[model samples]
Target: MQDKQLNKDEIAQLTEADWKQRLTSDEYHVMREKGTERPFTGVYNDIDDKGVYRCKGCGASLFNSDNKFDAGCGWPSFDQGVDNAAIDEHVDDSLGMRRTEVTCSNCGAHLGHVFPDGPRETTGMRYCINSVSIDLDKNEH
Candidate 1:
């Protein structure tokens, strides 16, 4: 099922406490605190199912199953988001490394990092996402 995207007003109205209550501890850590789940430990790491992955924090559609691919990176990798508007990217200088951080466009929740070393056949971008940061809605068709 496709989720309704939340407006900025709705996203801004949600306090930290509300977010804490809405998301699990792990989800909160990864999505709200910009934490990364251990490699190979994420639920979606090896999933090849057909679905749309949405932000766990706000349920915003972020990635389509068609874009997902196994990069052997121990995380759920995708070539791109559902669209350009579904995610926001920023320069991350944390952990002594520079990376492009991907976030939910609606709520500014961290999703993961994107790398340039992806399949050359596709967009050449690898969206290395944390499983706790997203929920997948399996396509029934």
Candidate 2:
């Protein structure tokens, strides 16, 4: 298990082979290649556990269970990240559609996309993250 997040310098020093060796095929596809898992097929989709979601690539704290909600969009949905620095958003124009892509700030791993169609009572933003991009660190509260 990863105990610490990688710094920018460390992240920059990693090679493609280093990433492939660190992650499984699926994780590499989704995180390194900017691929997306099938909707409703993600392990974290239905899980409602109390924990922190850390970046699978660098173990950077990304999301809290407190910000999680059932967006019914198939992936694990969070209203917000753990902090502003934990996630970085970029303009994704792939798939012929304009969308905002979210990545782990610590390692530049592709997490998923964020949309505006979230619960209005909260942040009104849906962080549709891929299950393979994160690992849950369950904590008892």
Candidate 3:
């Protein structure tokens, strides 16, 4: 990948079939195609399961269940990440709106978005992530 953005057609043609072959159906849809999965349908939504969540695309450690929080917005929300450098934030202005998009810093797999409207006690931010974008490490904590 280059520092310059790849056009959709360019991105769509960049060995996507290779990625499809490498990823599960759901993961291919979300990560390679930017498809959003329905909220509350994810395994992590109400999970008490112990683990570290990693980027499905590249196995990069992202979040722990300990950092998971119920944002009441139907998505598995977290006020924090496994670490400050665990992910990267990008500017997204699609759909006539502006938002900050988040992704795994290691692999650039889209996790979801971050918002300023968060609990004031900590970072005051919410990283609303897609369950399909992550793979649980299962009790690494």
Candidate 4:
């Protein structure tokens, strides 16, 4: 894993070839091609480890494990991202449905989608993320 966080400037300079070289087939599919992963198959789906989930494409911190929750939606869900700047949401009108697509702000890598149906006590937002688009940086403390 990259110990240093990648900045947006560095990410912007990366091309498709660089992305392909940096990410695996599965990662490139989800993070680069904006494809979804099979539900309940992501490595982080059931994990409750404490740490930050960094973008697989740019090593930028996107989600904190403390915000993660089991939405039972097959993918790893989070109430929110690390902060407002960590992720960017866009309108996705694919599959004849209107949804909010989430992407890493640093690298513009597709992480997943956001839904209004989540824990009501919290943000009431479920950030359904693809595991292949992230890497867990477990907290040592």
Best by the lDDT measure: 2
Of candidates 3 and 1, the better by lDDT: 1
- After superposing candidate 1 on the true structure, give the runs of residues whose Cα lies further than 4 Å from its correct spot: 1-5
Q: What is the TM-score of candidate 1?
A: 0.93
User: TM-scores, in order shown?
Assistant: 0.93, 0.95, 0.84, 0.96
> What value does the lDDT take at residue 78 in candidate 4?
98
For model 2, the run of ten residues with the poorest summed lDDT: 1-10
For model 4 the TM-score comes to: 0.96
* Per-residue lDDT value at 8 in model 1: 82
- Backbone clash count, each prediction separately: 0, 0, 1, 0
Those runs of model 2 whose alpha carbons end farther than 4 Å from true positions after fitting are none
Global local distance difference test of model 1: 0.89
| lDDT against the true structure, each candidate | 0.89, 0.93, 0.78, 0.91
Q: What is the descending lDDT order?
A: 2, 4, 1, 3
Cα deviation in Å at residue 138, candidate 3? 1.6
lDDT of 2: 0.93
What does the lDDT read for residue 76 in candidate 3? 81
Give the alpha carbon lDDT tens digit for every residue of 1-141 in model 4. 667878768877888998889889999999888899999999999999999999888888888898999989899999999999999999999999999999988889999999999889999999999999988998631
After aligning candidate 2 to the native by TM-score, how far in Å is the CA of 16 from where it should be?
0.4
